[model samples]
Target: KHILRYVRGTTNMGLFFKRDGTRRIVGYSDSSHNIDIDDGRSTSGHIFYLGSSPITWASQKQPTVALSSCEAEFMAATEAAKQAIWLKELLKEIQSIEEKVILRIDNKSAIALTKNPVFHGRSKHILKKYHFIRECVENEQIEVEHVPGKEQKADILTKPLARIKFKK
Candidate 1:
């Protein structure tokens, strides 16, 4: 299978972490909207890194169906924010260091919704749980930022990629 080949081909590749001055916890959130043809649901993915090395990552199907790409991205960011909170608490307890948690999302609109408390026709129907990221941003627990699609590390977890792109 391709997975087996990939693993074999990358036998020498691995994540390497080094002691750095910055103790920032950076996260990337991404979603593939309407990827599930069965129910039109979306896939959510998140990856967190301590300094420049990845610490944790997750990819799962979303529970609810998102009506728009923005909604899907918002839900994904919410999932990532929950993990960020847990990581923040764990780091605080274990290392006694409060690091800056920044979650990068490629969707700018979703980032805006988190920063601004706004409701309209498009976002009114979204579940209240998806709004949790807004609270996270307001409390300064984590920052939701904008990242370009090509630089979105979580993209690999959300959707399938071509052979060339996958190698990258």
Candidate 2:
């Protein structure tokens, strides 16, 4: 099987965590819009890293159908934001994490929606729960920033990628 072959090829490879590295938590969130043909729902994906090593990740179908790509991505970011908050709290018990968690997203519109409180007609249909990320941003708990699509690590979890691209 292709998965078996790939696993065999990287049997010795693994994530390395540096003791002297930064303790900040960084997250990458992405989505595949309208990926589910049966219901036209999207797939949300996210990866959280402590320093350069990945600590947590997720890939799951959105519960609600998204009408637009921006909506799908916003929902994905919201999911990641929730995870980031949990991680922040966990880390606090060990050692204080003073810096705000950085959540990287590939969609510009989604980033804008989180940073701006203004309600737009296009986003009026989004569920109220998904707007929790905006409150986190307002409280200085998480900071959402733009990441280029090609550099979004969460893409690997959302959909299949070429072997060469996946290696990156």
Candidate 3:
């Protein structure tokens, strides 16, 4: 009954994707800084969309604990990039997409990491699985850019915020 009640409340919660919508697929990504009290691992959150409607969204704890806030955000961005590429391929199968996916991340350091070739000592310990995003960047399949934290929509999934912040 609780599940049914929640479902009823979510009657307006739906995503609309149109065939004629713009081929531009964009993504928003965010992360919490050491929110896990037990292991101190950060949580990564991402949402991808076809035009304005979201096609995919996820929020999960990072397997390894991050050393810094930037590292946590960087890992979250990497996860988003991975999903963007997958969605691109899926969309290509249904229809041709002209515009490359643009990923918006709130952390500037994470954006810089995507462009930087040399990995610093602190970042070196990150799992190799996340480097797939680097390959996507080099191939120009996805581009990560800086976005101000105040406007990061994915923040809602990653961490709690004030009602005013969430409303914006």
- Name the best candidate (by TM-score): 2
lDDT at position 145, candidate 1: 82
Which is the winner by TM-score between candidate 2 and candidate 3?
2
Model 2, residue 24: C-alpha shift (Å): 0.9
Off by over 4 Å in 3: 1-20
Clashing pairs in 2: none
Give the per-residue lDDT digits (tens) of candidate 1, residues 1-168.
Answer: 999997899998777888786678999999999999999999999999988888899999999999999999999999999999999898888776565689999999899888988787889999998899999999988888899999999999999987777767
* 1-168 per-residue lDDT for model 2 (tens digits): 999998999988777766656899999999999998899999999999988889899999999999999999999999999999999999999987989999999999999999888889999889999999999999999999999998999999899999899667
Whole-model lDDT for model 3 versus the true structure? 0.84
lDDT of each: 0.91, 0.94, 0.84
Better of 1 and 3 by lDDT: 1
For every candidate structure, what is the RMSD over all alpha carbons to the true structure, in angstroms? 1.6, 1.4, 2.5
Error (Å) of candidate 2 at residue 148 is: 0.7
User: Which scores greater on TM-score, model 1 or model 2?
Assistant: 2
Candidate 2 lDDT score at position 15: 75
TM-score per candidate:
0.92, 0.94, 0.86
